[model samples]
Target chain A: MTADTVQSGLAAQGYVASPDLAMALHLALSLGRPLLLEGAAGVGKTEVARALAAWKRCDLIRLQCYEGLDAAQAIYEWNYPRQLLAIRAQGDHADEAKLFSETYLLERPLLRAIRQPIAPVLLIDEIDRADEEFEAYLLEILSDFAITIPELGTLRATTRPMVILTANGTRDLSDALRRRCLYAHVDYPDAGTELQILTTRHPTLNHHLAAQVVGFVQSLRKEELEKKPGVAEMLDFAAALAGLGVADLSADPAILQAALATLLKTQSDRAIITTEVAQRLAGKAA
Target chain B: MRGAVTRFAARDPGPAARIAGFMGHLRANGFRLGIAETETALAALATTDCSEPATRRALKSVCCGSAEDWARFDAVFDSFWRNGGRVRTKAVPSNTTPAKATREAEGQATSGAGRTDASDSQKDGEADTGGEGRLIATRVANLRRRDLREVVSADDIRLAETVARRLGAALRDRRSRRVKAAAKGARIDLRRTLRASLSTGGEPFRLKRRRRPDRPVRIAALVDVSGSMQPYARPFLAFLAGLMRADAAADAYLFHTRLVRVTEALRDEDPFRALNRISLLADGFGGGSRIGAALQHFATTHARTHVDGRTVVMILSDGYDSAPGTDIGTALGRLSKRGCRILWLNPLKGWRDYAPVASGMAAALPHLDLFAPAATLDDLAALETELARL
Candidate 1:
């Protein structure tokens, strides 16, 4: 997508368009290299892809990967039950047509992304979670934009899908996969950007109120919380603050705790930042 | 005073907030670097003006490599400004008071000794004591605790921190000695000197010039993995992983009752997963701590296999024994005499009153060249810095 469209679209959504992010996205598109975004979870790596799809007028295809994932699970899986039933029903006269039709494969995310007539922006979310074997399989698809299937032979992409691979750095991705991808590591937004995020997502929030809320959440990140809040949690917190009409620090303790659910995602984090700290923090930040 | 503390805390709220979030747990137990006192220290450092050398030095001293950590302390202190800790917010606190007693300052071992001057360790009485004509010795004495179970909290981060501090102090002593020796004339060896002279002059009389040998220290760590150490195990492994990353001459082994080489396993990116891999490959995750078996196996079998004179074997455990695991002392004595230093790292050593009650502790104490604690994150970091000196 054009830079103007990206800038305006994200602005319309209330998120400030960072020049660094824009440049990285533009460079990835221009070079035809897949973007590898590594960051602490929820630092807007996935959001970048969604935003790109919105600005580019393309469909967004997401492939969620987990442990013990294999090539078949990623590309396509043959309908075993249907094939079994067809073989039994076809009996003596079954022949080639029955066998071929019975073995019809169901397309998975990778094959769908590769075979699409119009390329979509594909997000292989949590790529680090997949095992080494599954990662090796992606190397060819990532580079050549093609995969060899025994049944259907090499399936070539009509157009390369705009790919974004996000990793939480749980494990190191193989050098081969990383070699073909452009990379960036996103960190938590600075105070002003968080305030801007609050304004974008919850326009009803007062300017100072949004800053105070962002400051508190940022403070929470530093405070040895069991599970730290991310950018999404910050936005959720701002929305909560706006919903409660908490324009200033004079809000009741109950109102503050009510907003706690949005920011403190983990029960442990909430418990650690007990009602006392939250109240005191609110008083201090306000 | 209130306004400055508030402002100071506001700017440096990150580490404070983290500690403050669990102040109750720390306060009730009387932990040294409790949330409130850490906040007070954080505030004093933050608002005192970085333009001043003392403030800047304090800032550096308090910081733990992250802006977030600084901010957390600031935020916590800000709340303390509104709340208040055991420390007074007015002016400077007493120099004689133990850092633990000061609200604005957490318990620092060097508090009574005054500010740390990197270049002035000799005058400050923290200099190396051995192998010199004049030795500057300051008693940076051991923590009162002698046993692990009684003093050490099950919490890994806290344990690692305390251990790191003690280990760090000891390391500084070892390093200062080494540096002083390395700085002056280290006498050249003459026996093998003739071998080099025969090649050039066929004359055994002339001394060939040689560089002073700085032998690389080999460090080997063995951690207990019995149920008692379930909490500290992960952080211990993580701290080991960081040491490995620093390319420390270190190898780590885990033992529930049987020792397992976890060197390759901990090489993985994720520390938790690496520990899991060890637990699975070893499966020695739940028996008794075979201190004797572990040490004997290491000394006779392991140390002989990979170590020379400069090796340092570190044992991280509570020293609990179910079996007659005290037999490992003979092997330790053998290893120690062979030029390998045996270090016993007890997490309990950080507490007020700890004793070596276990058979393992009893057996191993006499043989150990150093006894340290690895009970807190700071302890871990200090251990790292100390080793870096070595």
Candidate 2:
């Protein structure tokens, strides 16, 4: 599909994609390559996978990555307890082959995605958190769309799943992992896009309130705070204001300060975003 | 068809030259383009009309393997593809209006017209500047290819420092085998499983696992600063300083007749300040070369703790041992057996058909995985490429 269609399709699923991201997604789909997205935390990196899955009406298989994430967690594992029970029950008559077969196998996200009748959207979130060896191990799966189990031999995908790998730029990924994927960067959105997203995600929020929230969050991102608020924060703040029966962000500084907690998570960040900064930002136009 | 072909040829150069120039610009501006990306880009262009906006998007999506490359690719693509059309359309005669001609000339400059006819531009520049530009260019080329031991000018040393700084980030990291308990791991932690079984009446319900620990690879560089190595010492130290700056975990030692840890002194970002501090701390500077004694010192003090299987130990010297009393071979053998990969960089390796004939070099050669020249920038680039492969 063309980039315009990709953009419109994602919009249908409530994802406001930038032109660059739309083009990247289109190319990734056309070329049948994994789309690797690197950005700061909570910039809708994982949402792209969700939107793509919703757009295609396919299963979204998510594999949350962390340090020391290995093939056992990502692919498959044998049911050790079940095997023990079988050993006890059969008493030397237990079939070793059947115990280690698909009957006793527990499939993880990677293996489940591979065994799907139709291609699913496989989201490997925060891939930079994984170790380099795990990244290297992904080379075989990414390149050939297959995995080798010592007992089961090689399991190739029935249908090649659309893979989306997201990174928060915590560490550098291996060159081998990078080479097998198409790349895109999703940074913080502009005030206009954030406002649009705010209004779209929270229709109960008025334009003035959405603008004030976007302006406050955008200004906060520029501040020397530990954690910056994302689009999700804007949505949360809007929801908080709507729940508090505040029609406009032109409310009192005290009310705005209390509502700001829904956006800023950290204590230091909340301390930094005082009533004065919030009032000043809320008064300004987006 | 013949008329169409002639018109195409008249309006534009072949795609190969244009793509080559674009790729060259990307490389010069620090965009890492792999061979696979280049092949994919070519394949994409073959099946699509490159002038279309969709094709540019497709090309960019395939060509950029990392997010860092996207911004640069966009800038170059916007300037190059658009300017290609503008330049071709504005191919006017010299007798055009002066204002229009000047505007076209400005456009040519922005479009990198000089790079398209680089030789002609160089000739024209030489004629205009009267040999000064050509002289500087020739000197720089010679300095880059010449041995570091023969460098005399301060300008050449400064230029080498800049190149060495760029080469610092090219060192590769090694993975470790030590495992730690993690949320997602390969092997089951039987100990944890047994410990948890007590809570479940000696029957474990959930399985705990362990994963291999990841550590940043350590680099320990031993630079010779004796009288024989005096000429090349500053450049090599600059290279080591750059490496230390790129990797904070890297260790540096300066050895003449003795080994001295200069990691603190060389931590200064300013090359001049770091060099001054190094000169002050190196009391044995320009003294008699003693590779054997220095190796023995490093082995006895720091080898057991710092140098390990994941460590890459680099020894930069001319390999001349003034005092042969201490055994250099034994120290190197111990370091090698400790799992440290030894890489020996000799400044005289490429000069006058040189060989490892020096006593110290011959002894260390058996323990070395890489023995390359450290005499020129090109040699350093080659070393960087080798490290990347490792």
Candidate 3:
């Protein structure tokens, strides 16, 4: 699909991407490269993958990355319990060949994505959290569109799965990893974009209240807060405001305080964004 | 920007020449553009509409190998394409006088023409006008060749940053033990081949071969932020920041009397902002050097977790150990035992008469795989190239 069509499709899925992101996605799809999206936490990096999968009507196979994420967890693992049961039950009749067959193989997200008859969207979320070894492990799969299992040989995808790798930039990625992917850096949206995103996501939210919430969050992001509010937080804040039946998001201390917890995640951030500061931000946003 | 490129194109009337010149300019400015990338970029430009955004998008995808490459590509594209028109706009009066004035003002500030107090600034003024396009290309070339010891002014620092950023992105690859099945390989995948033969009643019809792929070498930067390294630390960290952008697996730590992990701080895209954050975060900044103690601290705390066979530990310091009898040698010995390659970078090595005279230097030298200067942009480029070879 063209950039314009991709943008339209993404918009249909309620995701608003910048021109650069749209272009990057378009190129990635057309060129058959993994799209690497880097951004701060909760800035819709993973959501973009979901939206794409949803738009394309494909299964979204997600691999959530962590500190010690390894190939066994990400790719495939032998069902040891099942194999052991077969061994015990069959006695001398237990076939070693049958025990290590496809029936015994438990496919993880990566392998599942690869083995799908139809191409699926494979989302590797927060890839930077994975250790260097695991990242290195992914290079072969990413570049060659295949996985190797010791027991099962090489499983190369007949239809290439659209791959999305999202990182919060906690750690640097390898050059090999970066080179294999088409890159996009997703940041917090501008005030107008955030406001639009808020209203779009929470269509029932009052326009004035949504603006106030987005503005308040934008102001907070400008501050040196340890954990600034992201779009997800803004949505939560709007939902909270809706719950409170606060239509205008007035600078009233009680109303602001009630919904404030939804936006600020950390105690230090909450401490910094005092009632006084909220009132001022609300007043300014108005 | 598109209008500027269009105007320049109209005057130049040679898109091929202009594009080729831009490619050369990119190469000269340390882009590492391969022949394939150049061909791809050219083909992209040809097939795409000539609109500025489309052109940029096309070239970006085809030409850039990574994010760092994309950034440099954009910067050079802007300068090389727009600056062509900008020179003409300055010399011959344009319809947009205000725009011309604004650009000229920016050019003066960037060019550092008036600040001739420094001899480098004097050289800057000579290349500031008439040959602005040629000037940018030559400036980068000159900056790459100049020694870090000669860099004294802010202008030189800016140039040094540009060079450092380029060097940092040029990361080296290392062989990994991890093997994957390939179409052709040196080793037979017995397990995989056996597994595939199950369909034919244990009669092998298909063969599977495995090949080991090259993995990015993990770079662990231990920068000394002591007073002795004050002059070199900032640029070195900036270089590390560049490496951070290029290689996400790269780790950074700052040490003076203590070792402080600065990997988290260096996540900022802006190196200046990262430096500011580092200053606030690391207590070791501008402190006294305790090389042995810091190495011991790192070895005890972070080494086992971060350093491995694939890791290359690069120490950026002057080798001034505050504690004389401290066993830096033993600490380095421990790190080497972990199978991490050691590279000691001393700024003093940039000096012509410099030697490894310091006690800390003497102790650590035996464990080092590579001992190189970290003082200048040239040294950084050389170091990166040398690492790539290893």
lDDT ranking from best to worst?
3, 2, 1
Model 2: how far is A27 from its true place, Å? 1.1
The worst-scoring run of ten residues by lDDT in candidate 3 chain A lies at: A167-176
Predicted complex 2: DockQ: 0.21
Residue range B57-101, candidate 1, lDDT tens digits:
232223211211222333233333334442322212223234223
Measured by TM-score, how close is model 2 to the native structure? 0.60
For candidate 2, the per-residue lDDT at B171 reads 53
Query: Which residue segments of model 1 deviate by more than 4 Å?
Result: A1-9, A12-17, A84-91, A101-103, B1-390
Rank order (by DockQ, best first): 2, 3, 1
Better of 1 and 2 by DockQ: 2
Q: Over 4 Å off in model 3, which ranges?
A: B1-3, B6-24, B27-49, B61-73, B84-390
Indicate the residue-level lDDT of A234 in model 3: 85
Specify the highest-DockQ model's number. 2
Give the whole-model CA lDDT for all candidates, comma-separated. Answer: 0.58, 0.69, 0.70
The residue-level lDDT of candidate 1 at A179 comes to 49
Clashes by residue pair, model 3: A172-B248, A172-B249, A173-B248
- Cα error, residue A220 of model 2, in Å, equals 2.6
Summarize candidate 2's per-residue lDDT along B305-380 as a digit string, tens digits.
4677778888898989976633788789767877878888898987878988777788888888988888755577
How well is each residue in A1-286 modelled by candidate 1, as lDDT tens digits? Answer: 4334555776665556564445445555655667777667678888888887776678889999998677767888766556556656886766755444424778888888977777789999999899777888888788798877676677789878999988876555665666456555567888788777777777767778877888788777778554578898888777777777777753788888878888777776777887899988887777
